[model samples]
Target chain A: MARPDNARYQETHEWGRLEKDGTVTIGITDFAVDQLNDLTFVDLPEKGDKVTRGEAFGEIESVKAVSDLISPVSGKIVAVNDGVDGDDFSALKKDAFGAGWLIKVKPDNAKELDKAKSLADYEKQLAEEAH
Target chain B: MQETPLRAEHERLGARMVDFAGWYMPVTYTNIMEEHRRVRTKVGLFDVSHMGRYWFSGRDHIKFIDKLVTNDRAGMKPGQIRYSLMLNGQGGALDDVLVYGAGDDATMLVVNAGNRPKIWDWIQRQRKGFVVDVTDMSTDYAMIALQGPESANLLNKVSEVDTKALKYYRFTRGTVFGEPEVLVSRTGYTGEDGFELIMPQAKAAYFWRELLNVGESLGAGPAGLGARDTLRLEAGMPLYGHELEEHINPLEAGLDWAVKLEKEDFIGKDATVAIKAKGLEHRLVGLNIAGKRIPRQGQDVLRDGKKVGTIASGTKSPWLDEIIATAFVPANMAEVGMSFQLEFPGKGTRTMKPEEMRQTALVVPMPFYKRPGKK
Candidate 1:
């Protein structure tokens, strides 16, 4: 799978990208979506909700299991993707890094992006974990 | 882990395997949703060899089984099949099983895989005064099910058996695929026209591959345990561990039709009689969720804000395109159209609204997706 060049990745498989404004776009990685098999439900945090870094913001359920969606960066939610919360989630599978973005957050600290892994580093981490 | 005769073939087909009841079996050949949809609309083959099979025979075989099971076995004719429950002395279910009468002096039991050893030991301990001998036949034979609307037509193209004439819950010993003698029974867990075939373990793989070859041309493909579960759940079939359990009585589990209360002395008769007189405290009912979120087993069932019961078996119904579940609630509260809330515990946040996390459900009649002519 191709990791997007514009996004910074977290160890827990979430991705965050700095926008033109002070806000950031966040979503789970394609690798995470693949591990979940078929996505049945994506519970997203409400807009204006306060989120802390490395904490769970919502949950995602597959047919067989449920997983927590961990936040990659601490911020205030500026926008939420209502389409992803709807019945069909094929868009999430088809474009994990593009239209599948879960939420937009106004970051508490923009420098937190420095701690996020680059595309190459995230791919390397995934390769190392495969062993 | 134990492997079925078709285990290697499943792996070669790129099936996703999982450990199920000590056996390495295919949970899905491809995607679960696609496989589930295939069985609902077309035909699908399933390898169910992991279930425990046992044979019983002697002068006292019929008498012993009649005394042990909750269903009447004395009136069963040769080649008849009946679904029954074996209960403990407390009227709790031991296991729900299918009793097949091979003859007046012989019978067979097909039981759940996880409870095979326990059921064997329980029956054997009660055989001291009987003349019957119980033999475990699980390894000697392998089984497969061809299920869906097109099952009979698919089988007719490959087998000599008169598939169209076979009645539901009846079996015939006949040759299949021109190979060897096998027992073909018109029975299935999915609410569809189907057949379960039992053959010698040595010939199982050969027949499996042959069936797939012919069946594929007819739009039939190999399904797996994942599809099997969704199909059965949509059909309102009770799974052993989920709906039926050691402490769950058959009466409360909505299996009163299988329990013969007036039959000559049987296990749990006294307890069942007393319970019947007093009426049941709880009853199983089907819940149809209004929206998309699927309720899972062990989730709390509530009325208003108070917990009323717990979910037993639940699934996202591929046929209905909705979420359906089976739960036990107070007998008085189990009427159709009764509303309730399924409370799924939020994992991370205590900040989410209670209404946001819970899904509304209503009680509905069971066998949720029953096919026409499925008695």
Candidate 2:
């Protein structure tokens, strides 16, 4: 899947999109979902939880492995995606960008996302990893 | 890392390759769940050439083997295969192996991939006075496992061998794809009735493609190590590094049947007898967790907020659709109906209390998903 140009990505494969309300939506990239195939369970932080940039906030468990869900920006989580955290994962499996957003955080500083990689830069990193 | 004979074939199939036991092997073709389901319901092929294969010959072959392994190999009929464990002097399991009684003079042993080097060295050191010639045929021969309920039908359609006549744990030499000297055995790690084929390394790719071509309509496709692990775990088979280790004995691993104490003077017989007489301190037990959280290896098994044991192996069983695991707990707590807690550490850097992050685990019967019509 082509990454959205408006969003910024983390080297760990997380994406953060800034909304008009100054809150940033967070979710893992399609490459991450593909790598962690057959997800069995997902653990997300609760609403009002604090998240630090480049830190693990939660975890994602697949059949074969367990990977941490890294935060792209440091902030206070205003909302958590109940749909992804619950038993059903159809929304996360179908669309990881829009419907599969894990958490919405009110950032301490919106400039924290500036350290994230752009779409072109993230794709380049993925390409190099492929080789 | 070492590459198998079918490495190119795996790459062509777009397999997700990983370094397993110092060998470049495929972990999955697509996803583990799909491939695991295919094996349980239909059929699946696996490239298992990385496992060590050794051929034994000479007059004292059986004698040498009987002394090294724990099983009673003296009574094994021709073409019979028996699972056995090789233990150190302290009664700790060195490696679990398969002993193939090819004939009165010739025998074969298949060892785990990770322990190939260690076992090879052990065998060389132990063959001192015995007049047995052991040849490592791992590179010269390639192994493939054809598994599932539809495996027999698929094998019958492609090979000249009458798979229907082959009894469980029995093998036959035949030709596949017009290539001669293929040894087909009715044995597998998975609980399903399947076949393990050993053929020349040079003909591996050709035979693999031919089998897939003929078996495709029978719902046969290549499965990778990921599926193989889940399938075996569901079948309640113990893996080497997880359940069996150099410090873990077969008796504690729930593999007592494979360790024959009645046999005369095996390597670890005295220690095993002592262990049996003194009674077991710890035992391996199957566990079923309450939720979807998987209990990974080395995770603490808690009882009353205290560490009581360690998880040996665990996974979200694809067939059973439950969180099943095996753990080494006190023998007194190894009975069914026993309940414990599996501690899951918080992923965040912040410290959390033990009681805050834990899952309920219950002791349950193993062979979690036995194949239909199997006793």
- TM-score for model 1? 0.88
Tens digits of per-residue lDDT, candidate 1, B1-375, equal 788999878978888777898888888787678888778777889999999998999999999998889998888988899999999999999999999998786899999888888999999888889999899999999999999888888888888899777899999888897865799999988888889999999988888888888888768888988889988988989998889998889999999999999898789888999888999998999999875567878888999989999899887887887889999999999899999997766543333356657788899999899887656
Show model 1 residue runs off by greater than 4 Å: A2-26, A29-35, A52-54, A72-79, A104-131, B344-356, B373-375
lDDT tens readout by residue for model 2, A1-131: 66799999999999999999999999999888887877887877778889999889988888888888899889999998878873567888789998988999999999999899999999999888764
lDDT of 1 by residue, A78-109 (tens): 99876677445776888889888888999999
Among these predictions, the greatest DockQ belongs to: 2
Q: Which stretches of candidate 2 lie over 4 Å from their true place?
A: B345-356
> How well does model 2 score by local distance difference test?
0.89
| Model 2 interface RMSD over true interface Cα atoms | 4.4
Could you give the CAPRI-style class of model 1? acceptable
Q: State each model's CA lDDT, in order.
A: 0.86, 0.89
lDDT of 2 by residue, B1-375 (tens): 898999999999999888899999999999998899889988899999999999999988899999999998888999999999999999999999999998797999999999999999999989999989999999999999999999999888878998878999999899877878799999998788899999999999988888889988998899999998999998989999999998888999999889888888789889989988999988999999977678889999999989999999899888888899999999999999999998777574222334446788999998788999999
